[model samples]
Target chain A: MQQDAARLKVTREGDIVQVEFTSRKILDEGNIAEIGDQLSVLVEAEHRPRLIISFAGVDHLSSAALGTLITINNKVKNRDGQLRLCNISPQIYEVFLITKLNTLFHIYPTVKEALESLRSGSQAGRLK
Target chain B: MKHLKLQAGPRGQRQSREKSVGLWCTEEFPSEMSEGRRVEEKILSQCRKHAYGQRDLFALKLALEEAISNAIRHGNKCTPGKNVRVKYRITRQRVDVMVEDEGHGFDPAVLPDPTADENLQRTCGRGVLLMRAYMNNVVFSPAGNSVTLTKFNESSSSSDTPLSTTTVAFG
Candidate 1:
């Protein structure tokens, strides 16, 4: 399943779907809502259960984005699916640490690593 | 409550040739999310003009967004006719931002902790946490209708000054 939005680009690589945020800053309220809607659509579609959200181009993320992520994570988990995040910048990384969200989701330093781990069936330490 | 008096320059350097630059802007927007975001962008543009570093800029930007959004969504209840008031002061060393909504305020102490085990998965309640985490000081009026956030520029030499003793009122 592939989807596109003004600020997000989604493509599926086998069972692992990758959603890349193209915006430099994801702090705008309208943009945040649109991104959330797109992700929710993906979750409801149920085409590919596994997801990897790439934040390579994102420079800033507000609490609204964090909330959206939590909503999407819960949606995926409810269906026995997995959600992973990769390429989070140091600034955003600090926020995850502050909120202790670093422990709630599987975060990887690179997209390749996240995809590899999910494909290898390494679910022991990868969840949360 | 620690009152921040708006000072014109670096503390205790009033005689120095390097004077402080102060900027004040107040804007009123309808209780719409997009309008709140526009105000946040405008404030961030001004902060960048004052030469805020990348990390500090990002932090302030996030905090401001959360504050303004809360004022519009929660305080104003997104009522079409209701408006949110945003007032901000930018100095060489710090930025003071205040957001007020035209509604009854709620107590901040009653808010649930988003970081707790039971609340960890909650989609909301994290905005206040983010604001407190990123800003130097976060204060609410007795009525809770207004919130003030202060963030000191880490790269500025005057950032070491004590915040409680240097309070100055702005016109």
Candidate 2:
């Protein structure tokens, strides 16, 4: 499944859906709603999905953004799917650590690594 | 009306002179998401001009955004006629921010821990956590209608003294 929104661009890579945010700042409330709506469409689909969110462009993230990620992660899990995050900057990564969200989501250093792990069907080292 | 101003002498004065600029502003914004974003951008630009490091800037911006959004959304309940008041001060050594909403406050002690196992997958409770983690001091008014956040500049003086402190009146 593929989807596009104002700030989020979703594309399929094999069985894994890659969702990339186009905005540098993902803290706005409108952006949060748009992301949630788009991701919800993916999770509620008929097939179980494996997803990766690329944060290459996101430099600033707020609690709203983190909340959206948690909500999406739950929806994905409810459908027996998986979610991973990649390409996060150090500053954004610190926020995830501070909130202990790094424990909840599987984070990879790069999109390539995330895709490889998903393709290989190995869940090791994805969540640490 | 920017919230900060800096003044310094010529570079070749041969004697180092300390420049201090203090600014404070109080503005009432409609209880809307867009208004909160605007306030965040204004505050962030001021922080950048004051030479805050990238990590510090990111933390301040994120914390400020969370506080403003909380006031507009939860505190005011997005009421059209309601307004949120924001007061911020920026100086050479630190940044202080306060946000107040025209709504009945809740007890801060009752908030859930977002990092808890059962709550980790939840969405709504992380705002308060982020605010506390990023800001050096996060204090709420007795009624909980207002919050004050302080971040000390690491580049500022080495003394442990805080640049400024304000006491919020409790109801």
Best by lDDT: 1
For model 2, residues B78-128, the per-residue Cα lDDT tens digits are 999999999998764578899999989978899988888888877877888
lDDT of 1 by residue, A1-128 (tens): 77777777888888788989877765455678888988898887885489899998788887888888999999999888989899888888888988989889899888888898789866444423
Superposed model 2: Cα runs more than 4 Å off: A1-5, B1-21, B156-171
- Native-referenced DockQ of model 1: 0.74
Among these predictions, the greatest DockQ belongs to 1
Q: Could you give the CAPRI-style class of model 1?
A: medium
| Deviation of model 1 at A106, angstroms | 0.8
Estimate how well candidate 2 is docked, as a DockQ score: 0.70
Q: Give the C-alpha miss distance for residue B51 in model 2, angstroms.
A: 1.6
